[model samples]
Target chain A: MTDRSDHSRATWRQSLQGWLWVAPALLFLVIFVYGPALTNIRFSLFSFSAMSLDWDFVGLNNYLRLWSDPKFTTALTNNAVYAVISVTCQVGIALVLAAVLEARIFPDFSANLFRTALFLPSILPVVVVGLVWQLLLTPTTGLIDQILWETGLASWSRAWLGEPDTAIFAVIFVSQWQWTGYIMALFMVAIRAVPRDLYEAMEIDGASGVQQFWHITVPGVRETILIVTIITILGSLKVFDIVWVMTAGGPNHSSEVLGTMMYRAAFRDDMIGYSSTIATVIFFIALTIGLVQIKLQKDR
Target chain B: MATARSFPALAVLNRVILWAVFLTLAVICVYPMIWLFLNAFKTTNDMFAATWGLPKIWHWENFSTAWNYGISRYLLNSLVVTTATVVVELSLATMAAYALVVLNFRAKAAIYTLILGGAILPPEVSLIPLFRVMAETGLYNTYFALILPNVAFGLPFTTFLIRAYMTGIPGELREAALMDGAGEARIFREVYLPLCRPILASAGLISAMRVWNEFIFALTFVESESVKTVTIGVMSFAVALRADWGVLMAGLALSILPILATFLVMQRQFVGGLTSGAVK
Candidate 1:
């Protein structure tokens, strides 16, 4: 009885030590992450500027304004479009490439070189990517347009980033170009981890290559697909840098996302309450999606 | 026998088509960066006229002009911020992960979840409050303003990553250390820290890359020219010189070169580190 009591005492002391180590990080998260998240709600209720503390409590007026505001609606709509298009294209291309690479479709191809080239853009600074794409898509002297004209496809060479209809799509294509490799890398590792014996067993049972892929490979990486889709969705929801630097959500705000819209509201337009409301909306959207992802993973 | 004979020809055609697709994708991915590089060496006229060709003369002056336009200062500021963020993030995460993974605590699961909660909470949600907090505390434009949020935001993922790795370390080793009368700090310092170098490097590299390339926070927090990081600096530079493609390309190249060089040298670690945490 004494020994068990002593062990319990020791465990309590060890727990105290453990919490001590976690205290500093917890403090930081409280101050920066959790605190700010909660405070965002408080800030959303008040009308104020950047630094001024004096403000009026406006209740749900800011959020109500969001419904009436055309820019906010456009930003929300554009974000939805960006999310749908980017997730489909990026995840779709990555799935194909990962499966192909895992299957070793071209045995002679340099996997290392291909991976390096593809991933290069993922790591490049968003500013650089925006600048480079801006140059390439410039109508008069841009390399893309120049090449299109030279190849007798001049009609296809109108300003890619200038027009409203094509601007968001253009941004989404740039996004796919930057991120597909990253998603592909994740999927490649997941597919490779699928057991080799399963494939061999299926082959012996007279399953064709396509049949084997559909039966074994697709289901094998389904969880990774889900996780990657969640990541891609969250990424598009918070995507500001690409849209900000590419077009500044311009050509009549055709490409504005929630992130950029939030920035413009608070900093550029002095709508702190409205900005915080937008921030709150973003938080709930992310939280709901994140919860769904977690629940799905748990169910699996 | 006839089926076997025809299969080889079909496989050969399959290989041909696959190679063509792969090569085309590779070219599409690589051609723009190469064009950017080639354009950096050309004058404005050459950049316009000889879009596909190599530069007649490498205009090294573009780099000098970019450097003089405060690119060097922006690079230094970014380096300092990135280093500080990495150090703080790794150290705090290491301690926290060690506690969560190695220590026997009842609320450890809840604590872990709380920390990981930061990962999903988009920075957009926190930006205004953080901005207000910084302004109130008089840290709005300081390096700490940027470093504080960077470290805080980076901590959850880094802690998650390090804890995942530390869990794989044999508990017997930690048990032995405890038996020898080693304290928690000592066990962490002497036993876990050394074993943790690889994972630390992984977390550190990934977080460092993120901090180095981050734009939104830097843009929102720091307003002074002296404190501006590379991404925002390069953006302003690009905006300022919209028509001067030579200087703009050179500035963009300069901004990217350091990270690209580091990535090349540590490509294996970067790839492994980035994809390591994403996997279940």
Candidate 2:
């Protein structure tokens, strides 16, 4: 009886020790991730300015203000546009690239070379990517314009990152260039995981390449597609580095998104409370997508 | 699987098309960096006049100018911050992951779910509150401001990665260690840590790259020239020398060199680490 009692006590002590081991990490999560996220909710509800300690509870005024603010609207619209375009182009191109590469159309060495070359851009620092493109797209003396004029396509060449009409698109294009390869690599992992036997069975049934892709490959990687889509959407919504570097959300805020807008409001415009509102919006959107991804994953 | 036995003509045409598309993509990915590299070695006049040509003169002065201006200082700051972050993050994450995987505890699921939340926690959402907290704590504009939050943010993903890898370690190896009168710490140190080296390398590489390349937090938290990281340094450098293309390019190139080298050397680990995250 004494031995049993001692054993139970020892087990309890071990359990406590286990928790103790994880305590440090949990402390960081609570302090940095969870604590601030919850605090942001309160900050969003208050009326406060940057660098000011005084605060008045404003209820939902900041949220209300977001509805009518033109800049906020543009930022939100731009984020949505970014999400849509990034999902379609990045994921779609990745799927195509992965499917082609997996089909082994190229010899082994060539395929490896192709992947390395494409993925090189994804690893480059976002700032460098921005600076290189900025130089390439400089209005008159840039290489892009020089090439266009030499090729007799001068009419097609305007300031790519200059005009409001083209600035956002140009930013989006650069993003696609940077990320498509990384996303392609992700899909390659998924595609490679599909059982080769399934494809062989379909091939034996006289299924064409297109038919095999739809029947076997698509279903095989459906879960990855959903996860990748959610990731892409969340990423696009929170995008900052690229936009900030490339255009500073600029040529008159044409390329402004939620992140840069929030930065400007908080830092430049001294609207801390309102910026928290934007951050809150981003958080909720990302959370919703994440939850949806979890649900879909669970169902699968 | 056997290669597709198709009509020769169709196969030939397919190969031709694939080669064209692949070559175009390769050029698109590679040409810009080469162009930048070439331009970095040219005089401003040469950069403008013969934009696509090889350098007439290999101007080593561009690098000297960039380094003297601010890149060297910023690089040192970045190195300090990134190294501290990686060290702190790896240690914390390893302990946490080990506890979660090797021990039987009641709140394991809840703790895991909470840590997973960090995977999606937008850093922007925490910016305002973190800024105020740092300022109040007198950590503002210090390396700790960057390092602490980076460590905090890094813990979740690293813990997740290490935990996953730990769980895959065979149970018998641990059981035998325990039967041999080994303490938990000894078993963990002797048995598991060595086994975890590959995944640790992967996680370490990923964390290093993130802390090294991070911009937003660095941009907001540290404003002084002395504390500014490479990302901010390069931004300010470009703005300060808006038309000095040679120096700007050199600064940009310098900022990328360490990360590029790390990536090339640890390509397998980096890709493996990234795919591990995806698997979650």
Candidate 3:
């Protein structure tokens, strides 16, 4: 009985020691992340601004205001459009590119060269990307317009960023240009792990190269596809820097996303409480995507 | 594999088509960067006059001009913030992961779950409250404002990666260390940490990259020129030098080149770290 009591005491000592190591990280996370996240939800219900410390509680009204806010709806719609286009281009085309690379159609040196070039943009700061693209898409003197003129397609060149109809699409295209290669690299890693024997067997059975890709490569990298898709979707929903730098959600808010809309309302408009409402909605959307990820992983 | 070669003409056509596609895509990927570099050397007139040619006079002064225009300050600020953030994040995460993985503990699962849950809390959602928190705490316009939140948000992923790595370490090493009368802390610092060097490097690199490139936090929390990171600095520089394309391009190049150079040098580690963390 005495020995048993001593062992229990020792275990308790060890547990306390473990807690000591974890405490610092936990403290920071709770204070800066989880704690502030909860406070943000509370902030959404109140009427406040940068000028005042007081938060006057006006429950549900901020949310009610969001329903009638045209900018909010436009932001939501733009984010949805961003997600769809991102998934289609970043995931779909990237997977195909990765599959081709993995198919051994080219020398290893050449393939790596292409991959390194493609991924160069992904490592750049989004600010740089946005700024660079903004310059490139400038009306008359930009490289893009210059190329169009050189190719006798000068009629197609317009103020891409200035047009309400084209601004969001232009921003989305730049995102794809920077990101698709990174996604392809991820897919390449997964595709390389797929058993080579499967391809050899398909070849023995007289399957075409395209047939082998569909039957073998696609299903083999299923989990990666799902993960990359979720990442792309969440990234699209939370995108701000590129849009803010390129358009500032301008051309009459045509390029407005939830992130930019929230920024403008809080900082520019000083509608802190109303902006928190938008932030809360962003949080829920992320939460929903995360839950869907969990569910899909479980289903697998 | 033999099927394609069975039809010699078809095989040649396929190869040619694939090569064409690859070369075209590569050009699209690389041309913009080449154009940026080319334009950085030209005068404003030269830039517009010859959009696709080499500069008539190499304007090396553009970089110096950009450096004087707050790019230097931004670079210094970004370096300080990124270093502080990565150091704190890695230290805290490594300790937490060691405890959760190696120590005999109660509530380990619960603690792990709570920490990992922070990963999905989008920064956008917490911006307003975080801004207010920074302001009230007097951390606003200081490095702490940026470092604190970056470390907080980075903890989840760093800890997750470290924990996954630590779990793979042999238990016998810890047992042997214990047999030698080493304390838990000693075992962590001596036995496990040396073994975890590869993963530690990976986590550090990934965190450094994220913190260096972070924008919204820098934009929101920092109000003064002294504290602004490169991402924010470049934004203001872009506005201030909008008409000076040569110097603006130089500034943009300066902002990106360091990270790009580092990436090129450590390509394998960067790719391995990114893919390994995601795939598992």
Candidate 4:
């Protein structure tokens, strides 16, 4: 009887071992991620301050205010411009470079070196990239302006970051510079993963480089392209550090994206309840775009 | 000229346009860093006077000065954070992945799908709430605050990736071990860990890069200089010394050097680690 009971004990432990396998990770996600998201939604509905545990429900007041907030409108428009311009350049250039790298069309070592150099900017901290660009594009004392003046184009010197007209574009360009490499690497990896036999079949059909790329390479990595697009769009929407670091949403709050605006509202304005509203807006916007991308990909 | 004759010229013009576009992009990509590189070697006056021109004298001393400027301490801090987090995360992820994949359990699909969907949520969405939570829990402004969240958020995704990769492994190895009367935990420790090394290495390195260069959390979570990562250190340097582009660029270069070194020395391993299970 004792031996049989020990055998049952062993079986129980084995069953637990199965549960234990995924227990820690799932627990962490559930507690930190899922729990926080639920709490976020809850807080978004209430009038809770950061220091207060109990608050009255504000209902849809936060959302209603967002409809009339000019700051929110500017942030949304700037985000749109940033997203459109950055995503277009980021994806388009990444594909071209990846194709060139895959074709081995450039001189030996040159292409790989360029690929590595391009990849370097992506890994650098956004804060540092922001600072570098801030200095490079500064108005009176900036290197770019100084260089233009020296090259006999003194009239071209402009305060790139200080002008409201050019400030958002500057931030977008900084973001674009940093991300293109990452997207390029993503494209390269996707290109690399395309099975060799598919390329061989295309070559047999007398397909040119451009034709084979359009038909075989693109089709093979359709999922990858979808994933990249979705991730890029989400990343652009939540862009905070580089803009905050470079421009501080400056030149009369011209460069403020949704993320930075939300941060300032919570931390600086000390409006916790209102910031929760902003945060919810950011979340919904990101989620909507993300879901739409996934659905679009599914339709394809 | 005949229209047909112009068609050949048009095709030639198109080829020239394509090459021009490609080369123009290459220049745009390389020239910023080239500008930074040249600017790093000039005096303060030279940088101001000849911002776009060659440095009168190579002030390589700026690199030395930047090196002396607590980039060392910040670099050390960044490495410590990354290494500790990677070790903790990989070990936890490995144990979790093994159990999730190989073991039989109830609620498996529901639990797994719930965790998988959490992967889609943007992390910053919960920042305000998390900050309040962290403060109430007495972990605010501490390394524990940063480390805990990093591990917590990173675990699900890493575990999911590892479990999927592990599923492609043959089941016979574990079965053979079981037949030999080896206990489950022992089989996991000795057999499973060794087999998971390649993917573990990859996952660990990727997490390390993320934590090492992570700015928003580091900025929000740790305010004091002592607890700050190299990322914050670089940001502070720029703020404190705005006009010193030479030192600032040198500092930026210094900050990224460790991560760059890790990539260069173990590039194959890093690449393998980066790309594994990611495409799927």
Candidate 5:
């Protein structure tokens, strides 16, 4: 490699030129991701709102005051529920679906069609997903309740997205429906990557199908599972669009996650300082969990 | 005795039940659009009477109203910002990915960790600071506010994807290219970049959708009516018509049309993009 490099002025030039090419993106991140993150920490220390230019230096008060706010407490609980429940249902369903699809029971073409069909919902715009679900779940005229009534199961019907008890769960269900297939596809690919020989050998040894899955498939995709776990944790924590659109964390903030709470505080309430504080807490939660996860994985 | 004979029959019944369950979900997933498409044509009266059943008359004009009223210049705003973002994001991501994979920087490991860390930093945290910067730089309420931030947020994902694909590339290619006196730029152009077209295609598709559909930042950062992107445009329409069912649905459909169309047509790219390095 060095010998080739010595004679090749072009290679050296390309190496230098490549940095120049990518410099803009790096600069963009420096200003946007890194720079803004620092600014967020700075904002947490200062009293600032979008409405006024005069911000006082109030060190740690914002973070300290968050502990006293009932709204933050409720929001923290809601975010916890949202993250845990959504990720479990979504990833668990994904694993089952991936297992089912990997069996290759259907004709190849039909199987691909089914896979594609299942994957379609994930790519649809979140606004559309929320609206479509809202309409479908509308209590009075909604097709879901209407269908339940028509089918003689009126007792089973309820205002799925409108009721306080059910709205968060409804949103979570919608998220699960959309995201499960996507993660399933990931599991499918990971499953497919495991050498067929391993599975065949397990079968040859008279291991049950379930046994093969436990012994061969799960181990093969442990890293991918961790990846999905982190993705789901981070994504679920930041999930605002669906919650914001569907219920606006409503039926009276019953579904209010941190994201919605932050949005309302900053934009709706004009309390930018409070919102940045919430944003700080959120950042710490995401960052700490992510670091802990990476540490665990590394230790493993 | 009867139960013992039923095992084979039950096995067949179980498979059938599984298939039935699968198709049931498929129906649930696809049924929303059937209702949406029909409702798009229905009067609000029809919508209230029943969520299902056919419209008395097709109201294709809702599309026009949404376009003319809700989208209009907002559509142009979306196109401009998304195009600029995808173009810039991909070009930069590709170059950076090449460096991360091919070059051995002194802090290469740390750089990689930084990139991964950047991926988890939610964009909302930056909203106020970004707004302040945009205001200070005098780019607030302009397309630049949305475009520049979108690109930055998009970079980590695209870079993650391109790097995944780059790992599969053989070191010998670089060596051979170097032996032939081709510079790294020439090799990236002649060898790596073209080989990465499929991955790039997916990255571009994902970035476009994200930029187009992004709402929170666009809502906050872009305030001018002329500069508003479609998501916030539709959102504002919904807010104004909070009690008006027909107009809200109309706005929703209108906002979704571009993304829906792009996703439907280039769905393969979306799927490819999701799997690229997203699930790792």
Candidate 6:
């Protein structure tokens, strides 16, 4: 009985030590992340401003306001468009590019060089990317316009970022430019993991290259494709720096997204509670995608 | 493969087409940055006059002009914030991860799942309330305003990666340490940490990159010029220098240079850290 009590004491000490080790991280996360997350949800059900401390309860009025708010609608629609385009370019095109690169048709040196060059922009500060593209897409004296004129396609040269019709697309195009290579790199890694023996077997059967790609590579990397798709979609939803820096959701809010709208509401317009409402929506969407991603990872 | 065996000429043509496509895409990917670098040296007149040619005179002063305009201060701010965030976040994460992976406890899985849940909540989701919290706590407009939230948000991913890494370490090392009468702290510091070096590097590099490039927090929390990071600093600088393309491009180049240089030097670790989660 005495020995058993001593062993239980030791076990208790070990558990205490374990908690001690995790205390600092838990403290910070609780205070900053989880705490604010819960507060954000509570803040959403009221009308408050950063200018005042009072939070008058409004009972989901902010969310209802979102439905009538044309800017919110525009931002939501623009984000959806961004999502679709990003998936198409970042995932679809990037997959094709990755497959071609991994086909081993080129010399290793050149392929490595290509991979590095393509992946370079993905690591850049988005602010820098946005600013650089803003300069490039400048109307009259910009390189893009200059190139169009020099190539005798001057008629196609207009204000790429100045018009409402083109502003969102221009911003999305720059995003693709920065991200496509990164996604391609991810796909390349996945493609490399596919067994080589399958390809050899298909070759002996006289299957065309496209057929082999469809039959072997696609099946092999399907999990990665799903993961990449979810990540790309999440990224699209979270996009802010590009839109904010490039146009600030401009040409009359044509390029507005949920992120910029949230910023405007809280900081610019001083509607803290309303911004919290938007934040809550972003939270739910991200949480749902994140849950799905976790589930997929588990299944894999 | 069959095409190469059955149709030699067609194979050659296919190879040529692929090469052309790859080269063009690669050029498209890299040329803009090259152009930006080249254009930074040109006068505004030269820049507008000939978009494709070399600068008549390499105006090195543009870089100095940008450096003095606020890029220097912003660089210092970013360096301090990134270093502090990485050091603190990694320390906390490594310790927590060690405990989670190595320690025996009843609530371990519950705690691990709770921490991992933070990864799903994007920083934007907590921006409003966090702003209020920062203001009320007097952290707004201070370096902690940036560093604290960053450390908090980064803990989840860093812990996840390090925990995963720590689990792969051989348990025999810990057993040997225990046999030698080493305390848990000593075993963690002397045994597991050294084994965790590669993963620490990977996690540290990734966190550094994220903190360095972070914008929304910088934009919202710190309004003073003294505390502004490069991302926000560059934005305001761009606005102030909108008409001066030469100096603007120079500032832009300077803003991207540090992270880009690090990425080039540690390409493997960067790529590994980024894709490691997905593969697992």
- Tell me, by DockQ, which candidate is best: 3
Point out where model 3 deviates above 4 Å.
A1-12, B1-3
| TM-score, cand. 1 | 0.95
TM-score of every model versus the real structure? 0.95, 0.95, 0.96, 0.89, 0.91, 0.94
The Cα RMSD in angstroms, rounded to one decimal, for candidate 4 relative to the true structure is 5.2
Candidate 4: tens digits of C-alpha lDDT, residues A74-189: 99999888878876877776777777677655665766666666666776678877887888888767867776877899898888888888888998998888888767777878
lDDT of 1 by residue, B250-269 (tens): 88888888878877897767
Q: Candidate 6's residue-wise lDDT over B1-280, tens digit each?
A: 3466667898999989989988988998888998999999988999988878989999999999999999999999999999999999999999999888777654666788888888777888888888888888899999999999999999998998898888787777888889999999999899988888988988988798889989989998998889999999999999999889999999999888887787789776677666565554
Evaluated with lDDT, which candidate comes out highest?
3
- Worst 10-residue stretch by lDDT in candidate 1 chain B? B1-10
lDDT for each residue of candidate 4 in B1-280, tens digit (9 for 90 to 100) = 0112336787467556656766666676667766777887877788777777888888898888887877887888787777777787887788877766666655556666666666567767777878888888888867777787787767767877777778766778989999999987898888888888778877887788778878777777777777778888887777776677788777777786666676667654665566565377
* CA RMSD of all predictions: 3.2, 3.4, 3.2, 5.2, 3.9, 3.5
Better of 1 and 4 by TM-score: 1
lDDT of 1 by residue, A104-206 (tens): 5545348766777777788888888988998999998988898898899988988788998888888988988888888888887888789988987876776
Model 6 segments more than 4 A misplaced: A1-13, A297-300, B1-4, B265-274
Q: Give the per-prediction TM-score of chain B.
A: 0.95, 0.94, 0.96, 0.87, 0.90, 0.95
Residue runs of model 2 more than 4 Å from their true location after superposition: A1-12, B1-7, B265-269
Q: Report residue A16 deviation for candidate 4 (angstroms).
A: 3.6
Select the stronger candidate by DockQ from 4 and 6.
Answer: 6
Q: What CAPRI class is candidate 5?
A: acceptable
* Count of backbone clashes, every candidate in sequence: 0, 0, 0, 2, 4, 0
lDDT of 1 at A266: 91
lDDT of 1: 0.85
- In model 6 chain A, the worst 10-residue window by lDDT is A1-10
Q: Model 5, DockQ value? A: 0.40
How far residue B81's Cα lies from its native spot in candidate 5, in Å, is: 1.7
lDDT tens digits by residue: candidate 5, A116-142: 777877767776787778777877577
Q: DockQ of candidates 1 onward, in order?
A: 0.54, 0.51, 0.57, 0.40, 0.40, 0.56
Q: Candidate 2, after superposition: displacement of residue B179 in Å?
A: 1.9
